[model samples]
Target: MLRFFFSFLFVQIFLCQTSIAQTDWSKQLDHYISKRDEIDAVKKKTIKNLLKDLQSTREEKNRDKEFIALMQSVKAYEYFVYDSAFKYAQSANRLAYQLNDKSKIAESKSKLSLIMLLKGLYTSSIDTLNTVEYQYLSNEKRKEFYSTAYRAYYDLSGYSRDKHYSEAYKKLGHFYSQKLIDEFKEPSFEKLLGLALQSMVTGKLNQAEDYYIELLNQFNLNNHETAIVTSGLGFIYSDKGEVEKAKEYLMQASIADIKSSTKETTACRSLAEIFYKEVEIEKAYQYILLAKADADFYGSEQRKFEISYILPLIESARFRKENKQKKMFGLIGVLVLVFSLVILRQLQKLRQARKEIVRSNQNLIHVNEMLREASQIKEEYIGYYFNFSSQYIDKLEDFKKSISRQLITKSYDNIEQELKKYNSKKERQRLFEDFDRIFLKLFPDFVQRFNQLFDEKDRIRLKDELSLNTDLRIFALIRIGVNDSEKIAGILNLSVNTIYTYKTKIRNRSIYPNEEFDLKVMAIKSV
Candidate 1:
């Protein structure tokens, strides 16, 4: 049966069997609301509303498989956050791949790369964007891909710490000359926002203002787009030294931007930055602090850096002086150093002792692991023995009974004793293959789930090459409490070498390449 996925026409929707199911968005919303006292902030509040919107549409016209997968992608992205935006982006990228939607793949990868740049992972961001750069697609789809890539590269260059801004400038130029205008001709709320931000980055204040104004007219009065566009325009004006005009727009932008759960952080941050320039110190500090807290919560490296660049200026000089004075306490310092040295010597001795104890513990642990594996193997062996013995014993008992009944022969009493021995053997033999069926059933899914970590290219390269072969499988099983590699080998009908080969292949596929098999095992331990 061909299963249909009914995911209401999200960009880059794809059909696949292993579609992820969307959770009840309302349930999540209520869950957070129930915990409302514990959750407070513009960003979090926005997340809440985003959840509501997604849920609201669940009962709408298009409820299908594709939509569910997209929801899962969104949920997962929100759930597992990091200091870098790249991680969420990567997950979304994988979600796209699973769906077989090329547009989604590009969007996810591009967004992740963009976040990475904001988080100071410039090289990695650039590498990711380049690796997934789109070359063959429809005109609209192609524009989406390059536009994302353009922003990613541009942001990456700006955060590079190195002085080469040429890459960023060039990408910015390309975005302005091509992607921005093209997207504007047929604006998506999401893409429109990006273009507005891009306009500002390229220093095209007039163009930015134009885009913002156009967006304002296009968006519904109270929507996320209105506030985002308004705030963006305010920033542009502020950048060009038009403080009064900037403040006016931002103050107005705040109403829509702050109200919508989708765009409060950027709105708040922009407002804060403008207020600071106006030297509304207390008010400025309040908004900046709000922005800082929001950024930290979301792991927004971009926001963190924005705060960091200006932190020293506003820092209390009195605290600095006090710290300097404390550092100059020479007598106290010498006394502390002496104590520290003594503690260090003691710690070193303690560490050496601990190492000895750990070594002993490790040996004991290894023995225990071996025992557990042996136990499982013993079970399997018993099962096999009982399976064969039960049939054999039954046949033997029947033979004796048949002979006695036919001939009225002597030693009929001995038949019962022989039957008892056979029964005992059968009972012992019944234990093997107890888990074999179950284990085999779970193995396929295990492969799929673990492989899900990689993108299509990674999976294809790894799978076709038989990269995560037997050795890695052995250890992986061990990691999950399957200790008997020999039993595993028996099940696989191959020697231990086959298992070792699998390990080598998996390690080679890793970001850190390893040639030493022993070291690879040690590394897997850490991973």
Candidate 2:
């Protein structure tokens, strides 16, 4: 019973270990997908450094070092750039031939075959593979040779689309896949990949998924490995009708392929077909275009031919969707245009209303200014009138008293002399002085400002600061809005003809044009 318990414990332990080995790495896969661009950049920088090392090895003139460098360059560029990888592989093959190294020749030919397969030259790839001597290749090179041969036959089978030829090609592919699996003594990435591919081809989807998942868990995969494993899972899920899981895996695979700069990939094309079936036209069109671009970049004629079949269907659907959206947008645009015109018209009306309000405010301000000026004039003239009237009354009373005294003394000559004592010219001169003082009091800067309108040489020079010249007085009245020549003539006690002559003479001497001179005068601000 104790021995039975030990055996049972051993079996349980072995199953537990197997289960642990197949643990899910979904989170790590997500992390790699998210950091695709960053990872791609690092890989590209590594390739750049490797290329520099290749140049240094060539310059050293060491054939062995040169061969190693060329092979390293081929490995570095294998996933990133197929053309460059092919060129390096060819160079390595030539160097190996020149060195007469059979092992190196077989390794270089295996690399060339893989690159040719990626480039859609399937027959050429198979021909190149046939030239490689399996006996001369090392264990690792033999595994690589079998892997490339399996992929070339598999791809050719798909490309042929003929029942007889496809079956024959598929049989050859299975043979190579079995050989690749036989190369490994234990589970490895390549071995597991080969097993998964074999199961997938033999319609053992459950077994294939198990193998791919185990590969994912067993290795810390680079971008290239991640893409291959995820792509296999995607195909398995798709075949099992688990569409959502298929899409998720395919998306991850596509991201991984992009990160590795692997352009010879079918993930995008598969995704395009899935999305197209779901009637997701935009996504289908987008992925189809990306597939076409990758095919073109990788120079894959087979991939291009495959894309050509589905591209037009997705493009037609997308064109119809776009036309429908354009019609809807056109209607919306017309509504927006009408709304804008209405808003613009309302804006114009608002501006006009604002302008009218501004003009009304200006008119009210002008009226208020006129009222203030009129009030000032009335107050000043009324005070002057009272003083003048009082003086005249006092002078008349004194004259009457003097005449009476002369008459009472019977002196007629003395009375006549008293009447003659009053000088009219002197009174008129005093009245003129009062008028000048009052006008100057109303507009203190009137003389200086009025002179500024004329040329410097023609400007009026005042005899005294308190008085204005004839020209100054004429426009000063106009500045106060007494625009009539007749009214100005009456106020200054001069003839209308004299007023006109003074106005014309000053205007002609002014710096401004005749038409604009009055407007400029009016533009002068008041205190």
Candidate 3:
């Protein structure tokens, strides 16, 4: 009887352990199921933690590698909270690649690219995506990659102020837009859209509407699509200064029953902009309230803050308008009171409104002036800086030997001592400016040539500087036309490697497979 009890106890112990293991496995699977709900933030988090625990178990069992990748995706989705999500996603992506699980890898890559994009790391995003695009397996995946690349290019173009990059992004956007539209058995509709959007972005406003109308027709099939197309058209009309047409599309967009908070918020904002521009104050205010409601639903801090900043300004403008109207009404009661007193009061109030209007008009004028001044200043600086630099750089060799002789046994400290002899700040400033003008005129191509001498990264850093190192600037002058590196270096009071290093950095920054990207030629010549 005792031996029988012992056997039963052993069997019970073994069964309990097996049951616990099975329960844990089931719980992990449940976590993944919830995580698959892309919109559920809480589920995303729960899945992510569960995934970390599952990783060790997966390795121990030497099984379910795809499951491990799914967990990695769950963690990556939560990257909006922690920056490490990018790193974790990358690791999982590499593992997926090793496992030949291309699908999960693509998902991981897309997620990673988006994270980089949101963080404003456009260059890194582009670089990361370049590798991932090759792994795209489906048309959907290819469409996604192209879209991401297009957006990344747009962001990069904005930062660099490069029109070439902007055009490239526009082209890519059209490509992806076409891909998405074509996949729906509406090739003409998509083609129309491509032309419209491309034209709108490129400022060909006259041709955009027909496509917008066609896109709007799709709204019958998908009301949400209709809303988006109309809203886009409204904005385009707004850009063209056609306030009435803009309002029509904006109102249409606002009427859509959208589950997407972002879509609803955008439509509301569009409506508000139209109302504001049309001077429909009450309608504008109402639209803003509606926009706020949608913005709150979306949980986007950027949208909330943008609205917050605009709200007070909007309210103040409305208040002033209302009070000004009341003051106008007050003027009508002029005949009832004692004439002089009434006249005085009217004058005071009229004076106040006029003052307010004047102040507002003055502010507008000031803002316009500032804008004009800023534009003029920028154009003048770029034109003069580059043009003058080219001219000065041309004459670098004329004074290179003279400057080099003076500098052979000298130091920067000695130059500063000479600068100190100028007794007044004004004199010093004048002297510095004069020297700059002369030095730059002599080596006008110095900045470009100097930049040409750097690696790509260094060139980017240097191109941003309005002025460069004096000695290097001098060397750039010598290098502009003088091909001998050693002669140029000694003439500019620099070592041979200093000249060589400059040349090397410039080469690195240049378009690949080419060297001696002549700074003088590039700076002075236009393509």
Model 3 scores a C-alpha lDDT of 0.56
Give the whole-model CA lDDT for all candidates, comma-separated.
0.52, 0.78, 0.56
State the lDDT of candidate 3 residue by residue for 1-527, as single tens digits: 99999999999998677556434533443343344235345534665676676676666755355446554553434323323455455555656666677776676677667666655556556656765643454654555555566556544544455677667766666665555565545444434555566666667777777778766665343545566577778788888887666766666665542322122236666666656665667766776776676556434434555466445455556666776775665666564455547656666776687577657756755665565575465456557657756765664554465456557867657555555643555643443454455445545555565555456566544432445554455444443334445666755556988887876665556654332244233234211
**Could you tell me which 10 consecutive residues in candidate 2 have the lowest summed lDDT?**
19-28
TM-score of 1: 0.44
By TM-score rank, best first, the candidates go 2, 1, 3
- Model 2: per-residue lDDT, tens digit, 5-50? 9999999998666544222333444455457568768878998998
* After superposition, candidate 1 runs with Cα above 4 Å error: 1-104, 114-120, 133-147, 157-164, 172-177, 180-202, 221-223, 252-257, 262-267, 315-527
What TM-score fits each model? 0.44, 0.55, 0.43
Q: Which regions of candidate 2 are displaced past 4 Å?
A: 1-42, 330-527
Q: Is candidate 1 or candidate 2 better by lDDT?
A: 2
